[model samples]
Target chain A: MKIISSPLELKEYLKGENNSIGFQGSKSIGFVPTMGALHQGHISLIKKAKEQNELVVVSIFLNPTQFLKGEDLDKYPKKDEADKKICKLSGVDVLFFPHVEDIYGTDEVTLSAPNVRGYVLEGNSRPSHFNGVLTVVMKLLNIVTPTRAYFGKKDAQQLNLISLMVKQLFMNTQIVPVDTVRESDGLALSSRNVYLSSKERVEALKVSSSLRAASSMVGKNILDSKEIVKEMRKSLGDLEIFYVEVLNLDFEQLLHVEIGNTIILVEVRVGTTRLLDNIWL
Target chain B: MKIISSPLELKEYLKGENNSIGFQGSKSIGFVPTMGALHQGHISLIKKAKEQNELVVVSIFLNPTQFLKGEDLDKYPKKDEADKKICKLSGVDVLFFPHVEDIYGTDEVTLSAPNVRGYVLEGNSRPSHFNGVLTVVMKLLNIVTPTRAYFGKKDAQQLNLISLMVKQLFMNTQIVPVDTVRESDGLALSSRNVYLSSKERVEALKVSSSLRAASSMVGKNILDSKEIVKEMRKSLGDLEIFYVEVLNLDFEQLLHVEIGNTIILVEVRVGTTRLLDNIWL
Candidate 1:
């Protein structure tokens, strides 16, 4: 795998790749952007990209703007050497490792999240978070111009909003949502999982367990969103709950769950670490 | 020239054009986005695009968001047939004529202008104006993906803000600024010019004449921005002057003029019609 640190160099390399293949036979590029601490979740996204496209480009940059003022930005995990090895093993053609300075500028043109949709649930807790996510994603999309981009469904709101942005802005990339990769015990894999202590790790299982409970209730013919949420809250008893939302695919709140189009999302604090998980029904 | 009302068709056409030429030899698409009351000013921008690019695309979208309540959105000029003919005569390769429904959607992603820079000049008077301009321009740029997009220096503040957006976003297209087109008597061309009565038209000359007076003062070694603006205001004289200010290219208020990087801008109302003009030094 070729590791490119410069955005311009990566852009030129992609341009050359496109030119060499010619128009009729141009190779499709699949991109997976991550804030670098690779786990099975990221690898799953990369492997899916590898399957779909002739060339796979993965970007690893710890974006500062996405983190709120007192958030885990400073202590966020960084495994650059390990990430490189994982990309190589996963058949990533290019590992784009850009610095924050390369990705952002002073008083830059920014993307704002939808007033109604963007300020709920995760956005409600961390208000300006999705704005940063949308802005950086836009910058990366422009730089990569990928044929398709893969995102984990664990970040359901992010995925939904990104898809909306692509449609609204007429961006050409296809946003593919990969299912959440979890532990054998059901804890969703997250970079922030590294921050959890052994006790906190045990507590984190409740998040996915609650999602599983919701899934089970749906399977047994309980479709009312309020009932499912009530059961989920019971399963997540005494945990620091941020929000337990049952939303449609468009992120709109649903009174009753619609199978195949509903997402049961949860955000809970495992000690001081925040972990998010979702189950799409 | 092919007239495409649907954005999807225009996108497909551009994609086919790219594919036919291949990447290395891909034709450069110069874009000119307008509100569609074509005159010599719009033609000048198109001609400049034609000179710089292999293909030129012109979009006629009277963006409703850019107009404030009680503004001329309902009565905004529309000459679709004449605009189409003008585009063909100007050798435009494609003319994108999209309806508001085709261009916007509910709860869509939006672009915001810089807090300090955006809320002055045009934005100050019509507070949310530049946000609308930036949002629509971003949409148009994404839809067109032009090699170079042309704008007239007649809307200097708009031009500056757009350029800032392109640079800050790291957008691929080049923003080419064309000089303002004017009549023999020195009234800068605008679509709003139609709103001016014959007498109002004569009164509007003060905008350009005031700019010329500022230029003469600068030529005579008067570099103080305040002094130049004072002279400009005197020339403009009580014709419902909106704003008379001298600022650097970045739109920051300049204490003194710096030749080659200054703009003296003016906005005045002739009867009920508001007109804007500027001089880039």
Candidate 2:
């Protein structure tokens, strides 16, 4: 696998392989963006891209802008050597390990999340986070010029907003959302999962388990959104619950549950680390 | 030349082109966006693009979002068929004539202009105008994915904002500012010129001539910006002067004129129709 560091180098490298990646047969490109501490979750996304395209480009950018001042940006996991090994093992054609300057410049233009949609759920707690996520994603997409970009559903709202941006901006790239990869212990995989203390990691299971409990309630036909949220909150009793919303796939509040259209989401703090999990019914 | 009337159709066509037009070599895409009723100014932009790129695309969209509620959106000049004939004559490969629905959607994600830079001069008069202009230009640039986009310097503030958008947003396209195309009598060609009576059109010469006088002042080494504005205002004696200011290329106020680094801009009302003119020193 070829590892490219700078945007100019990546653009030059991708331009030569442009003809064999995506839909236009010879001139399409497939992109997969990750936050670097690659685990099975990122590997799963890479595997999907490898199956679908002739060339698969993966980006490992620990974006500083996405993390608020007091957030875990400084402590965010960085397994660069291990991450490179995984990319090579997973058949990633090129690994883009960009420096901070490679992605952001001084006096840069930025993206703003929609007022209503961007400030709900995850956005509610981490306000400017999505804007930073989107701005970097847009920069990466433009630089890569991918025909299909892979995003894991683990960051469900991030995936949704990126999809919305591509559609709204008329960006000529397809956003293929891969299913969230989870650990055998039912924990939805996250790069931030490393932040959990040993006991907190066990406690973090409640986030995913509560989501599973909500799914079971829907299976039993007790689909009242209020009742489901109430029950899930009860199940996640000791953990600090941020929200337990049973929203439609579009993140709109649902008065009545629609079987294939609903997402029961949970956000809770295990120790000091916040964890998120959801089930799309 | 193929004319695509709807944004959906244009998107479908773009999807087929994939990364070929933009990521591949030789054929560069040059774009010129206008609010129809194409005059020599718009024609000059198209002509310049034709010289620079292998494929030129011109979009005729009288974007409604740019006009305030009390402004003349209903009276915005639009001659679709004639615009098509002009594109055909100018060697435009594609004439994208998208309707409002093609560019904007219900409850859309949009681009906001810079708070400080956007809300000065024209933005001060039409408070939300630059917001609309930036939002639509973002949409158009994404849709066209042009190598270079053209704008006339007559709308100098608008040109500045668009260039800022491209740079700040990390957009790859270049913004080419063509000099203002003028008529034999020196009136800067504008579609809005249709609103002017013959006598008002003659009087509008004061807008450009004022800038000419300002240029003469600067040429003679009169360094004070205040003196330049005062003389330019005097040249437009009876016309309603909106603003006449000397500023550097970055739009920062200049205390003293510096050749090749200054732009003297003027705006005036000639019998109720507004006209803008500027000279880059």
Candidate 3:
């Protein structure tokens, strides 16, 4: 596996890979972009891409723009040498490790969100967060030039926005959304999950538990959104409930359950670390 | 030359192009995205791309989102067959002709500008215009993964935004900014120029002339921005003056001309069509 640090260098290397070999007599590229601190969740995305494409490239960068001023950006995990080792183990063909200056410049053109969609749940707490995420994603998509790209559904809203961007912009790559990988304790995996204290770790399960509880209630035909939130808040007692939204897949509020189209999302403060999770029905 | 009318068809064709023996190592894709009515200016852009890349693709799409509600969208030029002929004559390899439905869907994700940079100049008049431009450009860039994309400097602000999007988004293709093509009479060529009456045509030259006059003053070391605009408005009398700004290349208004870095732009109404021109010093 090659560790490519600069965007330009990775692009040049990818270009060579694209030109040198043929994909079943034609050449095609696959890409997976991550924020470093790799786990089984990221490897899952890469493994699938490797199975399908002539070439596979993964990017590992801890984007500062995505984290709000008080968020875990400063304390976020960094395991560069270990990450390279993991990439090699996971069969990643190319690794893109770009610096801050390589990804952004002064007086840049930025991406903003729809006023309605961008200011709910996670976006509400960190107002400018999605803008940063979308901007960086757009940049990465352009740099990789993948025939298909992989994204985990752990960040459901982000996956939705990326799909929306690809559709709206007529981006040619296929966005393959993989299911969220979770721990044995039913905790959804995240790099930020490390910030949780042992006590906070126990409290954080309230997020996934509430989502599961909501799923059971919908199965029992109790579909009212307000009723669902009421039950969720009770289960999440003592934890600061940011929001427990039952939104349609589009993130629009739904008064009743719409199976396969609803997402029950939860966010709460477990110590100083904010944890987010959702169940897409 | 092949005329691809739907996104599905184009995607399928591109996929085939991606995986076929004859496709690999055969060509570089050059792209020209336009709003249908192929004038000399657009032809110049297409011609330039043709010269640079082995396979040229031209898209004639009068993107609806880019036009404000009260703008001339209904009356926007549509020379479809003529545009096809123009591309054919210019040696374009493919003509991507997608309808509105082919490109946009409901509840689409949008690309927004930086709050400060996006709300000035043409964006001020058509508040949602740049977002629309950026969104469509993102789509088009994805749809036609050209080795290089061609744009005109006549829409200087649009070119600036596209360049910014390409850079900020880490898109792999290079942005080839073709110089603003002009009429022999010194009027900058524009598809909208057709909307102008003969009288308005003569008046429209004021935009270019004012930029020319401002450039000469900046050449002679007259650095005051206010004085430059004041002189420009005088030369462009009887037109509804929208704004006359002397700013840097980044679109920030300069208090004084910065020798090699200033751009004096003028926006004024020649009849109903708003014309813009600038001198990049």
Candidate 4:
């Protein structure tokens, strides 16, 4: 797989070399953007992308603007060689590994997240985080111009906001959300998972378990949102809970969990690292 | 010209009917976005578009968001039939006339103008104006997906900010800066010119004349910015002048007018109507 760093080169490369890898059919590029250290979650996203299109492109950009000042941006895992190997093994057509300076400039024309949906849950905890996320995602989508971009349901809010951006901006590409990847123990896989210590690692399981409880509650016909949230908060058992919200597809607070339209989310601090997990019913 | 009101219909129309009006070869689209009172200024843009590309699209959207709360949004000139005739006469392939509802939504994902460049001159006077302009322009650009988009230099700051946005966002379309078209009497053509009474119409000549005086001074090697600004202000002669300053192409204030790299901008109120005129040195 060819790795390109420049935005212009990637745009032109995406345009002119449509059917380069001998998978010739109706031309399409499925894109998966990540902040490197490809985990099972990223691989799962890549797998969905590969299945859907003639070509798959993965981007590994450590977008700086998405992190808050105290957030561990510098310490975010970067398995560069391993990421490249993963891309190769997954049959990625091209890898976009851009530098911070290359992607951003001074006095940028940035994006603002939606006022209502953007201010709740993840956006609430890490304010300006979604703005950075959206700006970088927009830049990446413009650069890639893929037929379909794959986003995992693990970052449900990010995925939702991105889909909204594409719809609101009238962008042509489709945003396909893949199911969240989880470990055998039910902990959602994340790049930040590497930051957890042994004891913290065990504690992180609470996040997934709570989300699982929400799913189980929904399965057993416990439709009231207040009851689900109450039980989810109870399941955490003294962890640093940021929030446990039962929201609709639009991210609005829900009184009752409407099956097939509900997303139950959890953000809790396991040691110094924050863990996020969710169940989309 | 086929006029389309829906954004989806327009995108599909622009894509599928590239060669419908019977101009062939490489399939380039030149777009000119306007606010519906098509005068010589818009005709000039359409003329440029026709010369350059195989197809031409003109959007006549009087964007409500760009107008401030007390501004003349309701009273803005709307010569719908005349504008349609102008596009048909000018050989425009399509005319996009989207409604506010079709173009914008609740708590939308929007484009913010750059902090420094976007907060001066017109942006200063009408705060959040450029943000609205950029957001609508971004929506239109995405919807149309033109090969090259045209803007008038009469709205010099608007042109600069749009170019900056396209560059900063890594957008693919080329932004062509069309020279401002003017009347034989030297009044810059504007749809808002309709608001001027017979007396204010004559008084409005002072705006362009101020820009001309600055230009003539620069031509004679009077390059000092302060001196040029002083003379321009004198030329305005106690009218309701908003700002009379010389700045570089980057919109940063300049100590000296560096010939090809300078712009002299002026905004003044004549009666109850605001007029803007500028000269690119």
TM-score of each: 0.96, 0.91, 0.87, 0.97
- The CAPRI quality class of candidate 3 comes to medium
Model 4 ranges off by over 4 Å: A19-26, B18-26
Compared with the true structure, what per-residue lDDT tens digits does model 4 show for residues B16-66?
675354433236889999989888888889999999998899999999989
Per-residue error for B40 in candidate 3, Å, reads 1.8
* Candidate 3 lDDT tens digits, A31-99: 999999999999899889999987889999888888888877888899888889989998888888889
Q: Which candidate tops DockQ?
A: 1
RMSD, candidate 1, Å = 1.7
Check candidate 2 and list the clashing pairs.
A18-A27, A19-A26, A19-A27, A20-A26, A22-A28, A109-B168, B260-B281
Off by over 4 Å in 1: A22-25, B22-25
Fnat across every predicted model, in order: 0.66, 0.35, 0.65, 0.66
Candidate 1 structure quality by residue, lDDT tens digits, B232-267: 889988789889888888888998988888888899
Chain B superposition TM-score per model = 0.98, 0.95, 0.94, 0.96
Candidate 1 per-residue lDDT, tens place, A71-126, comes to 99999998999999999999999999998888886776689999988889899999
Where is model 3 chain B poorest over a 10-residue stretch in terms of lDDT? B18-27
Cα misplacement distance, residue A125 of candidate 3 (Å) = 2.9
Clashes of 1: 1
TM-score, model 3, chain B versus true chain B? 0.94
DockQ of prediction 4: 0.55
Candidate numbers, best lDDT first, in rank order? 1, 4, 2, 3
Positional deviation of B57 in candidate 1, in angstroms?
A: 1.5
